[model samples]
Target: MNTEEFNNKFDEGQSMVDDLDLSKALRSEQQLTRISIDFPV
Candidate 1:
């Protein structure tokens, strides 16, 4: 990829990483479940 394309992708990935939230969502039973990270390296 060209420099600009690489930079754009890098910036987008950085933004997504920065915006990640690790808090568990509560159900009616109030159980804490783990979040899945499915990204491939």
Candidate 2:
């Protein structure tokens, strides 16, 4: 969909998931990582 249609849908409070490719989408400035930590007394 063009930007105008997408914007209209968003402004109308409609769900936009069906028109989006979320697999490659990420929130701005966010990083995902898996970490492991060990501590010994």
Instruction: Judging by TM-score against the true structure, name the best candidate.
Output: 2
Model 1 clash pairs?
A: none
Candidate 2 lDDT tens digits, 1-41:
89999999999999998999899987996888889999998
Per-residue C-alpha lDDT of model 1 across residues 1-41, encoded as one tens digit per residue: 56786679787775444333547544588778899889888
Compared with the true structure, all predictions reach lDDT values of: 0.64, 0.93
Residue 8 lDDT in model 1? 90
